[model samples]
Target: MSFFSKLFGGDKEAEKTALDLFKGLFGENAKKDDKPEDKPEETAQEDNTSAPADTGADTVSSGPSGDSWGDDMPAEDNQYRHEGAFWLYFEGIFDIEFAEYRYEKQVLTPFKRIVYTFYSGETKVLAVELMSERCSAYKFRNDCKKAGLAYTRFYIDHSGWWNTRSYVVRRMKEALN
Candidate 1:
């Protein structure tokens, strides 16, 4: 099998192994099917689950638009909900020393937004932002370029679900080198 196929699970057995890994990490949240037979249904489910939660009236809102970090936000605000999957899939491929979340304050806007920085030893090798459906990653990409930093956006299932881990690993390796 091609390396891509092996990395991404070319056959049923390989696919089953990958699914098992995901299930071990995410439990019931990990999908069981190896095929895209129900992509539309999965997409709908993802859309509902991936959105930021409503804070209601009692709590102050915080995000790009709100005053506080917002409710149910990840420790790394820029981190996509599925980043743990990415880490689980790719950590074996790279010797990542550490990952950190950073905030960039917009001069024009009142919000301070988070972005991810990955380090290999002391060198900052990559910056990543996880974008939701309504958000675009262009600005983050541009910022990375201007700062001479390697960067990429991690979108949920940008490729097919089964292929995304391998695709992201390829992209990160390319960027790191």
Candidate 2:
């Protein structure tokens, strides 16, 4: 469905001209010297420019950011599961924070289902997994259909995640007073 393949790459002269046409059509905001091929090659193993995610793959890796993980996670309408996005939404949108409780491995179930128990003091909010990827969070939040996960970078040992737990405790203490 994308004509981008035909438009860019190979024949540097043609690519430059095509890019210029696009720049003129889209906007004049782009700087004059900014040509993709003009830049020095990066030393990194991976290409710096993004290649589109392969839709054919069963689970396109969320990679460093937590978007999808195997069959355990729901693939559609799952944006609230990302660690940064989930926490940011609560804090930025509602000024609310939920205290998290992580279990010590294999204690909860035999299946490799990973999740956390969310709470406000003694009251439990819900049990869910934080997944990565961008999807319609609205469906999960408002609709009858259930979903977990959102576009964000998160892992069990991510230090920022542990720090975020403190936000809820502080909120709880403030509420008590």
Candidate 3:
């Protein structure tokens, strides 16, 4: 309700004394029934039923990305680790080995290096490694240029656990073609 309506409306209850407003703002209402959270905060008991089930391992769902990563890379590995959003979105286009991939902090401080090796009927055609994170676009461009690839794009892997940003492993073919 608008301020004017509340102040001058037909409802008598809406006409509040200055003291009522003060008490509400300060949370100093005399009666305990004023607030729904009258009692102390309820904490879960140590019993298994009360407590949440804890799985030791942290896992993300195989990524279900809206991003059609690419159609260039053919489906060689029939048995992909997991079928994720990539499969459902572009099911007939291509087969991608989509899975719940957890980023491992490597020898290089924070960035997790992901490598993709392409094959044509058991013969290896290309193998690319996405390295060098957190640098400038110039740096990435330079890296891509140096590697002879046309472009580089950031593919977000949202499995489930954590929303890891700045991890770029998108199939360069997707955006270009």
Reference-based TM-score of each model: 0.39, 0.19, 0.23
TM-score of 2: 0.19
What lDDT score is found at residue 163 in candidate 3? 13
Which residue pairs in candidate 1 collide? 61-68, 62-68
Better of 2 and 3 by lDDT: 2
lDDT of 1 at 171: 58
Off by over 4 Å in 2: 1-111, 130-177
- Residue-by-residue lDDT tens digits, candidate 3, 102-165: 2121122122233344444564333333332222325544665676545432322211111111
lDDT of 2 at 42: 12
Better of 2 and 3 by TM-score: 3
lDDT (Cα, tens digit) per residue for candidate 1, span 1-177: 655367765765455545644554556443555222211212100212344444332221243321112233322222122334443333433333223422231222111123557765677678755433335547768888998899765443321122233445555656766
Q: List residue ranges in candidate 1 displaced over 4 A.
A: 1-114, 157-163
RMSD to truth, every model: 17.1, 19.2, 22.4
Give me the runs in candidate 3 sitting further than 4 Å from their true place: 1-133, 155-172
Please tell me which predicted candidate would have the highest TM-score against the true structure: 1
Predicted model with the maximum lDDT: 1
Comparing 1 and 3 on TM-score, the stronger one: 1
